[model samples]
Target chain A: MLALRLSRVAHPAVQLRRLAVAAASAGTGFLLLCTFGYALGEPEHSGAAVLRLSWCAVPLAATVYLALAVARTDPGTRPRPGLSALGLGPGRMMAVSAATTALACSLGSLGALLLFVQLRGGLRALPLDGGAARVLAAGRPLPVPATLTLLVLVPVVASVAVALSLRPRDPRRPAAGRGYGRFGAYGTAGARETFGAYGRFGARLRSGTGPQAPAAAEGARPASGAAGGRTAVAVPAGPAPGTATVSGPADALAPADGPADTDREDADGPADAEGLGSEADPHRPPAPRKPPAGLPWGVAVLAAGLAVEAYTSRAVTLSGPALSGTRTGSGPALPGGLDVGSVPVLVGWLLTTFGLALAGPGLTHLCGRLLQAVRPGPLRLLAGRALMEEAGRIGRPLGVVCAVLSGTFALLVLGRGPASALGPLTALGTLVVLGCTVGTLLTAAVEARQDRSATTAALVRIGAPGTTLRTAAGLRAAALLVLFGPLTLVVAYLSALPLAP
Target chain B: MVAPPDNDVLWARALHFTHNDGSPALSGVSLGVRQGEILAVGGPSGSGKTTLLRCLSGLVPAQRGEVWFNSTPVHTMGPLARERMRRDRFGWIDPVPALVPELNVWENTALPLMLRGTSRRRARTAAQEWLERLDVGELTRRRPHQLRQAERQRVCIARALAPAPTVLFADEPTAPLHRADRAHVLRTLTTAARSHGITVVLATHDAETAALADRTVPLLDGRCVRTVHLPPVQDTEGRAACSLSV
Candidate 1:
């Protein structure tokens, strides 16, 4: 009841975001209904029916992704200081967030049901009825139980995902090693690390399970893994950048040496210059000693994704000699005589998306560092640091956008010079995935901007000319575009070439 | 709108301004600041001190009236021109510290200078010098999130001073600091302005802060109640007994 009231009173923008979630859910639900229709249309081809059902997963994932993104950015769900007095603590807020997501998804599911019923002629006399009768198997009686099950899928899965993501945990629990590592409004982990610390590997970096690269650390390294397997480190947050005595990974060999040297420097370094000991400054937040991790992991994921796609395509192509009888359960060629939409190819595409999402934060951080690599003027330096800080919040969504675009382009390439293998279902799926991914990216950008508004106001007061800020914004956008555009095109080409007829 | 004297670095006449919602913010207030002089605009909260500073600093144009900086008609300037003017010659410090959260202390301090096309190296050196003077030199590499409110405020002050603008508009610059820190920062600011010939227009409700100025203009309900005109530089000592009565 409280969730419903909050939803009703939310800001129009917040309402709009919730509506977007509902729309995504509707699309996913529609896809599921269509999958069942395919099964009804061709009862003999159960394998094909299963294949069609699996295709719905793409839209399903997209809907859930959009729902979660919207939930994170929802102002009403966010916890405030005094709210705890009224029994709305972190745990309660998480439940509210989950409930809110479920409500939105349920609305979408209901919309999907109405639309499906109308199209299938269930509501015979309703306005705007009649279309896709043959494809929807309108001649047959729709199974009430299955239809209801498909409709509930989105809301159930979306709410569960939201609940799991927002579940309150002890900050010291480092073993979970999942989700983005970005700090949220409450400074809870992965409020955004740029859609976040780019998931599990980012968690690994945050928890200091991975070795810190010496160059990135600049000086004395921090201790690996806090007491009781926490992300917290015992070293000082501020270390002198000039005190590098050793090179390479510090955690790998001589892990003990890192703390000893760092403690001495922390005592003798900033403490003296600050005219206070480390114990004197109690307000400083613990700084991450190493640069954000996950770049290598992202690269590896991309390579593996491409390799899987390439191998799947090659195996499909090489099996051509045996033709109809011996292709080993690939569910026969499509009407175009192409082996596209096989389960292996689908798995490869998903991996590519995952890889791109994983690599995003690390790549964004690197972009920031490179911006300030040269003796950057104020513009580059400001732009660079902002990117690095926001890498976690924006990077993963950015990666997903890349994955969507590349997949769309690659599939188009495969469908060329033929009857255009993109059926209505394929087109609808593409549109939903494409729209949701872009929406997620744009939403993440908006959240990042909101987070940075105070700093922006400070810049304005500091007499930073309007043009300079715009130019910096342009530079950041252009850098990301330059980085992602080519990579997208390259991945598209590599993935499509093997699958192409 | 009589022309201000050439010697007055900042001069405002009949500066009537209204907030966007139609509330009066500044009402026909007038004041003049001579070259290298520290002028304090003293008032209680919502007495238009910040609005007055904004008008004088080219951050906002007065709804009505004329403002001149060294004989240039500021009120006549467009937004871009005013923005350019602010960037080139004016510096501002807000009541609270608001450094870019992502940038480290030195980077934040050097931001304005770098915006003016100064080399990063030169900006860093000047920023370091000002930061060291303000007792925050050691904190230069720290991000704003890691610093205390008072420490961050000092960095803001350092940032404002690093560019060495022709006029510095400090609006409750030390509000976040405790007594000891406030006194130390104000001393550094006033003494530095005196030595470097940087004209300062300080806005404060604190009597001690206003006491550092060479002249004071007190305002009430967006209208100045009284203004104490400055005597010749040779006739008065450096301190000005500026305050509000009523």
Candidate 2:
């Protein structure tokens, strides 16, 4: 009851996102009902009927995952501090989120059922196929129970998935700040303390220490604090520039290495002479350290996966005469003439998709670094930083979109290969799947934008023109497209080459 | 009431503003800021310090008073004009820094200049100059989430100063820093303002922060009660040890 009431009072944006989820659900429902119709149209081929229904599951599952992501990011659904005191903790909030999702899916399922009935000449008559009275189930009527069961499957799977995904964890392990990695919020352990301390296998370069390349292996160097017992080396948040460091009672509580080193280091830095002049007193400390950079190993992994897939498909094609009639017991292709190696190829494609998702954050970080590589104007800086910050949140969704794109292209190529290969139902199924995947990617972008409103407000307050922000947004989009567009085409071409006649 | 001086860079008369919750945030507040001077707006929490600063900076227009910037009535300017004025001629520092989480320290500091179409190299060079001044040059690559509260605020000050605006509005800019750090930040801020000929309007409840200013306007119940001018301190570096009474 609370969930229903809250849904009505929620923000309009939340309502709009929920509507998108409902629309995707409705599309899924329609596909499932058609699968059932196919079953009734050919009850004798139970295996084919089951196969068609199972194929519907892929798109159905993607839509469910998308719906869950939308729910998780919706600010209206977040548990408020007051709500916990009112006996609505994270567990109750999760239940409410699931309930809301279920309600939307159920509405869509109902719409599919109504549409199916209307198209089938009401509940009383079965439409015959082109005067062939024996083909459209002939005398076998559409089983109401079976049809209802298939219709409800989408809603059931979606709601259960939502519940499972949103269910509260132990609540003891605190959520990581900034979405990824083990770093706690500032002053605890930042990216510097984590990857830098661990001496990550790549992307580390030692400057000023010597002309030596950093060790390629993770174990080549001692941990950051191993030698000096420099535990908790707190870099004092020094007084602002141009001011003398003030020693006071508050200094006692700071960790041992606070501004004591800061004043000295401030004097040693070269830029100090120009900006601070002689006003800032001099002291000495070790040279300042640069932030850590992680290697983009994920990209290498994805490339290798695609290359292996291409090789496997070509090998299969080259020995086609020898392998003819050697089915490998993977069973017959379902209506589309897919080969026995289709399952393994599909697995390889999935592994590639995962690799792309994993590589997304690092590539995004690199994009940010490169955008500002030149003497960056403010516009480039803002955009670059935004890309780096949001890489984790949006990267996986982008990877998913790429995977969908490749899959769609490959299917289109395969469809043209065999006559009667692309049926009306199959085409409709393809459209629904591709559309939902794209919609999911767009929803993730919206979430990233919402997360940035505060930063936007701060910039505006500090005299940043709106055009600067718009330009930055445009730059980020262009950079991502420039980087990913060619890569997507290359992968699609390579993967399709071996499969095509 | 004493008339605003002819040389005042910013002047406001009988300003009034109300919050969205129907509470009055400012009432009949008037003040003037001299060119290149640090004017602190001091009051306890819930007082009109922030509201007055926002109104003076043209961030929020007052419904019932005149806000004149060098003979131009800021209250009557359109939004685009006000935005342009802010972008080109004013700077602001919020209490919590509020740096863009995505950008590292240097990028965040250089934003205002880049927004104005400054060349990337020039803006970064200028930004680095200030970052070094603020003693955070080494952490230029660290994002906001990685910095402690004090580090973030210092970066914000550098960002504000980088633009070399005519007037800088700071609303409790050092509220999150420890006493010693706050003193240092304030000292750096004032010295930089003085050297650059930039006018500063600082809002704070802390007497120490208020003491760092050349003059102070005390607010009570959304209205200015009095203005106090402090005598120049002989030892600027030792002013942190000086006792201040509100």
Candidate 3:
């Protein structure tokens, strides 16, 4: 039944769901860590310490759970049977997971700090010298209550914030145009426009439309009217240069027009020849051509700048004063303060963080440029077609496998804990995943509907017959998979949770 | 000797046409261009004259109907096989610039051969010979953008003929050229196909341009209205007018 379900689901959505599940699992893992920490050594009776730990743990947990839920609800499923798994590569999955974890941890920490500060302020009213610390540490049976409270609150705040912030915006909403008041909206629109432009450029390259113009100009007669000169060549009605066109063996032999001929032919076409020359002005300039395929220099410059900064920062740290001994200045410096001893570690961390931050954008940009340079012809068309088909086939099965694994892991973890723990954890995971899946599906459905509308507009412009029904069907299947899969898993988990004796 | 019905047929079986925007450009418009025959479709703008060529070559989708190659439907085949069919069965040259401008004359001419999975070295060698035959050998190393108008036309013609497709569709091939260049391009196209035993379909609005084809069919709106046969022209030496009929 698991295999059957997996077979029906698309791959990318499943992978996305798995990622969400993994995030939630990480939160569970963090909880396990805290529980184990408490079991190992109970901290002294200090309210501040207990508050700090709880604040940290709570947010981490919340972020992970929320992320998982969000992932579960991603409403983008396609019936890609065999190659669905390829949609979310292992590397991409790991990266997304790591980033989500870090973000959750950071947010949780901030929330915990805020609560710690608030509690400290309230505790100041007490008579104790270290009132803030004592109150945090105060709790029956080894101050576990305070610690648990901090752990739970920290993750909850962080998770809630992240869930709200990262929620995918409705794609159909009319994006705000440029201006200061609408800066956020405009930024999103700009990013979308850039993405669309890049996609179009890539498509043009894949289609072989960019590089062929120059070649076409050479063979045909000049566009300028010359009496008794070589006749202008007519444009052929076949595939554009550099564009992918499906054709049988017969298409390989047609005569193509040169640039000069193409221009002349356009001039002679019935639209131009009707001497509607007023509307069909022969001298009308062609649309501005986009830049040829190559890497934009700005990215390279930015990369170089980052590299220089990284090197200089590392060098400065290495050459700075040693701090093995006590500081000459007022009172002994804090143990964790920046010093020569910690310089190497700090440098390494900085380097790693900077490298990680730049890797995806740099690589993607470079690859896009490279792909552009390599003109698409017969080979690219064949490869692209094959890849798309294969991806469509494999995308769904992988998602199901991942989901099953996640479910099994959750069950194992729940079983290992006390009965009291099992009920809450199971319920929490199930509800989170279900809610996220539904939200994601709703978002995706709305977006798909908008896409269908856009496609309709484009078709109308070209006077072509639309395929709304087919597109709608595809989107519907996607929405169902995204929404139902997590809901089912959550229900199953809740049902299977061992009841308290 | 008359060719077999199947041999004369350029594309066997049905046809399908689909545009990118989830729209049907030519909804299963199918017809055949036989060996030694010229087939024409005349239509108003947007009647899908250019689209028909795209469908025949698999650039567009049929959405329905089988696009057969030698009686085998190409629509049912895999992408690689379909590409191979495009490379080896029919030569296509669109009205727009189709030659890779970055590539020199030889590279552009040998594209089809290269696409057929031919080795680069071998393809270039064959391309060189074709350029020579097309009388554009002097421009072999020149990029397409650097060549003159007439030179570019000849180079495209050379590229199309190099792979020797069974049938060729020239969509408004004479539309861009002046009277003189137009005549020269048409003459070159027809004569070259005749020698290679390739069928040609030249879609044009000009009546004079249609007269250049062995047979012309008027396409009004989206339907075929009439078919006309033109008188034969003299051979290379102007020795005699050959009687050509399809």
Worst 10 residues of 1 chain A by lDDT: A241-250
Report clash pairs, candidate 2. A241-B133, A264-A283, A376-B120, A377-B120, A378-B114, A385-B102
| Per-residue lDDT over A1-501 for candidate 2, one digit per residue giving the tens place of the 0 to 100 score | 987987888888788878877877777887787667766876676776787788788779777877877787777668777898999988899888888888888888888766666465454444532233233343556687887787777778887888898887652334334322322324343333332332333322331122121221122233322312232232234344111121221122132223323433342343342444222321111122232222356666677777777777777777774543434344445534555555556666666776776776666667777887766667776788678767776666777677667756766754354323666667766677677777777777888887678778888898777777899899998998887777677666666655565
Interface RMSD of each: 4.9, 8.5, 11.6
Query: What is the full ranking by TM-score, best candidate first?
Result: 1, 2, 3
Superposed model 1: Cα runs more than 4 Å off: A1-16, A40-47, A80-100, A125-128, A163-290, A321-341, A414-419, B21-24, B226-246
**Top candidate (TM-score):** 1
Off by over 4 Å in 2: A123-149, A169-355, A358-363, A413-415, A419-421, B1-5, B117-142, B226-246
- Which CAPRI quality tier does the interface of model 2 achieve? acceptable
RMSD of each candidate relative to the true structure: 11.0, 12.9, 21.8
How displaced is residue B82 in candidate 3, in Å?
Answer: 3.3
lDDT of each: 0.78, 0.71, 0.45
Model 1, first chain, TM-score of 0.75
Number of the top lDDT candidate: 1
* lDDT tens digits, residue span A254-351, model 1: 34335444443443345434444333443332333345577888889888988987887688667764543333354644422345434576677778
Expressed as tens digits, the lDDT of each residue in A1-501 for candidate 3 is 322243245467555544443444344444333333433344442442343344334324334444544433333321222333765433333333334434444444444444443433434553533334333333323354644554454344544544454443432335434244432344443443332232232532332343344345333222222211211121133344112121211122122323434454343344433433223432222222233222234234334533544454455446544433323344322112322333343333333223322332233233223332454443432222222222212222222222333334333443242222333334444444444333333433344344235323322221121233344344334433454356335523432232111
- Candidate 3 has a DockQ of 0.03
The candidate, 1 or 3, that scores higher on TM-score is 1
lDDT per residue for candidate 2 within B87-189, as digits (tens), equals 9999999987787766667778887887887776788899999999888887786556445566778889999999899999999988877888888888889
